[model samples]
Target: MIPAAPLASGRTADVYALDGDRVLRRYRSGGDVRAEAEVMRHLYAEGYPVPRVHHADGPDLVLERVTGPTLVEALVGGDVGVRSAARLLVDLHARLHALPTVRATDPAIRILHLDLHPENVVLAPAGPVVIDWANAREGPSALDRAMTALILAEVAVDRSLPLSAAAHELLMAYVAEAGPLESVAAAARLRADLGAPDAARLPDAVRLVLAAGAPGDRAGAGNLALPDP
Candidate 1:
C-alpha cells in the first residue's frame, strides 16, 4: 500500500490523508486506539456525527475525512466564534448524554468525554463533529459538562480572549435543556463525588491563568481554596 500523506499528529496518534476523502490513523502502540475505534464505530452507527470507519488494520484505522476548521481555531479567532463554539459544546453534550443508557452497559460505556476541549471538535457545514474519542468513557454528564466548562474557561483566560455574553447563556442553556432540578442536582453531586484530588487538580491546572494577577511567588503554590462540597 502506498503511504498516506500526513494530515495531523497528536500526542498518541498520527493521522494521514487517504484516497477519496478518507484518512488513515496509526496510533501509538499499546495505547487505547482500539477501544477508541470501537467507540467511534458504535457512536457512528447510532447516528452521531462521527467519522465513518472504512476499515481497521491492526492498530491503524481508515475513516472518512471530515473537512472543516477545528473549533479551537475558530474560538481563538474572536468573541463571536468563542460563543458559537460554547453553544455548540452545550448542544453536543446534551445530545450525547441523551443517548440510550442501555447501550452503555459495558463498564467502559460512560457519557463523559474526559477531554472535551474545543481542540477535539470540528465545525463543519453540517455542524459540530466531535473527534478524538480516546479519553471517552461511561460516567456522569456533570463531569462531562464540568470538564468542558473548565477547559473553555482556561482557554479564554490563557489567551486573553474575552468571554462572550453567551458564556453564561450557554451555561444556562445547558441547565435548562438538562431538565428539572434533578439534573442540576445530579451534576453538582457528580462534581462532588470526584473527591478532592480530581476536583483540586482541575482548577490548579488552570490556576496560572485563573489567578494571573495574584501576588508573587505563587508558582507551584497549593494554597488555592477549592469550593466547599
Candidate 2:
C-alpha cells in the first residue's frame, strides 16, 4: 500500500500517515525494516507501549498511530513539568528493562532500547507510549541506561537554560535509577560499536554526566573508563 503525505521527518526516517489507525515509519536507505519490526513485535508481546506493527515490507513500517504530543513537544510547549518528565521516563525505563529480551547479544540481559529519549516518547491517553525501536537490541541493561544518560548530557551541555535544566534533571534521574554505572565498564566497547546515531558524543557525555551527578545520586562518579565519544 502507499502512504499519504509525510507527517514528520527525522534524520534517518520519515513518518507518513497510513490511515486512521496506523502510520508508516519509512526509513531511509540501508534500513532493515524486518529487523525493526521484529523488535517491536517482541516488545509488544511483553506488554510494552510500543506501537503495534501491522506491516513491515521493504523500508516502510506500518505501526499503530499513537495520537498525542511527544514529550519533547509537550515540554517545549510548557505542557509537562520537569520533575514529572524525569519520573515518568525513569518509570518507563524501569519497565522496559524488566521485560525479557528477544535479541540478546549478551548473557543475563533484557531488551535494550538504545535510543530512548523524550523525543521518542508520546504522551498517549493510556500513558506514555514509546516509539522508535529501530535500535532495540541486547547487551547489558546498564549500557542501555547509560546511552540515554549520555544523550541527555549532550543536551545538558547546551547553553539554553530551559533545555539545560530539563536535560540535566533527566540525566541525573536516569543515572540514579540506573544504579552504579560501574556495571557498564566492560560494555563500553559494546556501546561504542552499537551504531547509535549520536554515540560519538557518548564517551564525553558519559564522563561529564557521571561526574556531574549530584551528591544524592544513587550512582556515584567513582571510576569509569569511557570509550571514545
Candidate 3:
C-alpha cells in the first residue's frame, strides 16, 4: 500500500513509504524507470554505494529505504567538515568513474552520475550511498567531475545563499583534489538546459570553475544529454 503523502519530494519525483522498509519513488511526469533501475543494479553488483532496487515499472520504482541524514545535513550539523566532504565527493567520483557502463559499447566510456552532489548523498549506516540515478549516463568521466564542480560553484558564487561561503571553500577543496576538469562549459549548458532558477548564474559559475584552475571548456568537449530509455 502507498502512503497518503510522500515522505520526501524532489524536482521530479516523490518518495513514499511502503511496507517492509521499501519506498516508492514515483516520477511526477511518468516515465519508464527500467534504465535507472538497471544502472543501480549494475552499480550495486559492482559493490558501489547505491540503494538497492526492489522493483521498477513505468514511473514507479520500489527501492530500499535508506535511512540517514543527507551529506548536506551532516555538513550543516557539524557531523562532517568541508575538507572531508570534498574528499568524499572526490572519492565517490573516482570510484564511480572506475566502473563500466551498462549499455555503452565504447571501451573508454564510463557511467557518469551527472547529479552527484551533497544533496544526493545519503550518510547511511553502511556508508555514503549515492541516490537519484535519474541523470545517469554513459559518458566521459570529466563531465561528471565538471558537473559537480559547476554545481558547487553555482552556489559558491551566489552570496545570497546561506551556504555560499562554505560552498566556496568546498569548491576550492574539491578542485584541488579532483585532479583534472575539462568540461565546465558542457556542464553549464546541461545545467542551464534543466531551466533551473540558477541557470542565469551559469556565467558566474563557469568563471568560478576557471578561477579554481579547471581547464573550463576545451576545443572538442561536447555537452551531454542522453535520452532516457
lDDT of each: 0.58, 0.74, 0.87
On lDDT, the leading prediction is: 3
lDDT of 3 at 9: 96
Model 1 score (lDDT): 0.58
Candidates by lDDT, descending order: 3, 2, 1
lDDT of 3 by residue, 1-229 (tens): 7889999999999999997689999999999999999999999999999989999999999999999999999999999998899999999998998887888888778999899989999999989999999989888888899999889988998899999988899899899888768878777777777554556677777778877877646442334342221
Per-residue alpha-carbon lDDT of model 1 for 113-195, expressed as tens digits? 65665678887778778887766767766557655544443333333345533333343443344332222223323433444
Regarding lDDT, does 1 or 3 come out ahead? 3
Candidate 3 stretches with Cα past 4 Å from truth are 216-229
Question: Which model scores highest in TM-score?
Answer: 3
Model 2: lDDT equals 0.74
- In model 1, the clashing pairs are 109-138, 110-137, 110-138, 110-139, 111-139
C-alpha TM-score for every candidate:
0.65, 0.81, 0.91
lDDT tens digits, residue span 11-117, model 2: 78899887799998888775668988998898889899999999999888989999999998898888997667777777887888888777564556887787788
User: What is the TM-score ranking, best to worst?
Assistant: 3, 2, 1
